[model samples]
Target: MTGVVRLATRGSELALWQTKWVVSLLPVPTEIVTVETEGDRDQERSLTEIGGQGVFVKEIQRHVLDRRATIAVHSAKDLPSTSVDGLVVGAWLPRANPFDAIVGCTLSELAPRARVGTSSLRRSAQLRALRPDVDIVSLRGNIRTRLTKGKGLDAIFVAAAALERLEIQPPVVEILDARVMMPQVGQGVVAVECRADDREMIQLLSALSDRETELSVLAERSFLRTFGTGCSLPIGAFAEMQDGTIMLSAMVAAPDGTRVLRGSLRGEDPEQLGGLLASDLVERGALALLSASEGKG
Candidate 1:
């Protein structure tokens, strides 16, 4: 309803797609303002090597903080556990698939001791949990690159929503259910960020917010924040709404995925439930795993 509301977004194809999708839900005229963040330009480095997944969101957040844009859109998983100064999550849209998909090859058909490409500690840890025999390697770059380089890989794990959004049709070997491998906190969700005190913007975004998705991810993210492991940690967490109850599962593992601890908690309140789930995991030795793992942001 306002004169061209500027929306800040990263230049990645996936990020653009997410931004455009969110924009479509808005009633006001929108001007998509793309910014090339460091993560987009540096394809040679791993996300952990740069600034973790935050590399993809920091620049766009800058636009919001600087008042260049009314809001910044991001894949919630890419954000840091800590909230940005001067900004807050105004809205959380409905989540997409939060499960990790085994692509290029099915998990069963992959050769013994087969090389699997993935840079996510979460994925690596989960894969190791399922099949400790497989080799895990750091395969960086975008989804397209990983899939292309997956020629030698028995398989690669990626977010199912991403593959679907990109219209990728790799014979997905298997879509690992969250019960097997909990997803990263905030995975499969998009968050709208705006100035914390901007009542107008907050109200606009609230219209798009889905309460169930918000509560579920809130619990998941709270669990992550409680653990104090940022994006670089080999941490996987996911929460689902079942019968009006939120069931959360989470796990933490060593970089090699040899040491892992997992647990679950269920409740109605996202933050409280997530905290309980995290405590259960910590009691099961998650803290020790985080302590041993290097580069756990």
Candidate 2:
């Protein structure tokens, strides 16, 4: 809080919202350094085609690495599962609604073979499982654009956190439950990253950290890292606190939703619990499901 903290972030509305949220909680003056990422530049292509979860984060982290900024703010879900050398996620803000929302129409309202838009493999696969008759098409862009975009589609799927953060409640939004379509790992969370050597800044940022949120993140992303995958794979995990222990549920599915392997595990150790859940999944042929898919999942 003694020095000016420059925050590097993607130049998107949702990204900015997450950045400012981090800034507001800190005691230091913040300078927003907006970076136009490869992901931002190419909205029409699927995320897997570009670079999966790392597409939006690498450039922003470059600013921090090169001393252009002090920290990087990102949607937690956009981050890669692997750790980056010389950098660490110092803190996480309190999580928000961690689920997907169907915008512009209800799930059952769309006609058979009705065109639906989404870019997430997890969402697309789950949607296909829910309604095999509907056509799932690739659609990309910001929250505003996706909500208004046309691909002869009946509706678009988006994160519930984005809409709620942007104060957008489209007339036909249907909040999909985690039971139906499990959420992406780290969804609805905001992460703040800093250089490994920046002790002062890391300590300051730690003050804003919520321990429960941090534990949930540890469990969720532990599964991702142990599984060794990122976005683009049809995988989903959601971790939450039940009473005092951490309860984790995860799913791995075929790209076409023909087969889904899922399991849950609960314990005190977040990391161990996630790892155990993943082991259970692998025993249930999750490795086959993961191997069948290409790119990061």
Candidate 3:
């Protein structure tokens, strides 16, 4: 809490922007230490093939664990549901637009067999469930790279928060409803991780935590955690506080989108609400869909 705090983050444009935002809020001066994660190194391979949930965050966390950085900044969606033993998320920035946006064309306007690009299995499964005729191409990279690669495709899915953070707006942007596409856990939140035993650092970062955002993200993450850590299947969860109660919605689907188990639950305790919702889905055969997805993997 005295000298400059080193922040570990990815080198991508969005990652830098997110880290810079954290720096702006910190009381102490900061130094950003950009680390190349496996996800950033191998953009060609699907995330599942490259190690799924933690692909973008493990290396960044390592920087903090090694004391190379005081904290690790990450797009919360990149983090796996399981907590790292030595690292802890100290702060949750205020949530942004927790919705997916379709660029280039509206969902309804796409022709049959139109190619749509996205790397997220959650998005792919939901899109397939909605438009089985369209092709879900494997597309990866930063926001700009994905936009550029989607030139010939009918459309591409991007997180609405990413575009908003970078202030880039395409000519055609259709924000998908949560009902149409439940967002990934922690989708629009920024998480700051630090050494769990570093009391000073944890205190400094915790001061910046947003209560409402923290609760919602906690609920969503709890829902995903019930499924297990490092789960790469097509699953999504979103939580919001309504009238002092937490309302959580989630979905589990087959990779081909043949079957999707959707459910919602409400409770005051975020963790309990998430667990109840996930348990309900499992009882309804969500585990079968997860097993089928694992078989494909």
Per TM-score, the best of the predicted structures is 3
The lDDT of each candidate is 0.83, 0.87, 0.90
Model 2 TM-score relative to the real fold: 0.96
Higher-scoring candidate on lDDT, 1 or 2: 2
Ranking by TM-score: 3, 2, 1
Q: Write the per-residue lDDT of candidate 1 for residues 1-297, one digit (tens) a residue.
A: 457788999877788899999889998888899998888888776677787758878999999989899999999998887798899898999998888888877777878898998877778776787788988888877778778888777788888888878888886657778777778889889999999988888999998999999988888888988876666778988888889999888888876678778788889988888888888878888888887777632
Q: Which ten residues in a row have the lowest lDDT in candidate 2?
A: 144-153
Question: Compared with the true structure, what per-residue lDDT tens digits does model 2 show for residues 71-98?
Answer: 9998989899887888999998999999
* RMSD after CA superposition, every candidate: 1.7, 1.5, 1.1
lDDT, candidate 2, at 212: 88
What does candidate 2 score in Cα RMSD to the true structure?
Answer: 1.5
What range of 10 consecutive residues in model 1 has the weakest lDDT sum? 288-297
Could you give candidate 3's per-residue lDDT for residues 89-116 as a string of tens digits?
9999999999999999998898899999
Question: Which candidate comes out best when scored by lDDT?
Answer: 3
Q: Please list the residue runs of candidate 1 whose C-alpha ends up more than 4 Å from where it truly belongs after superposition.
A: none
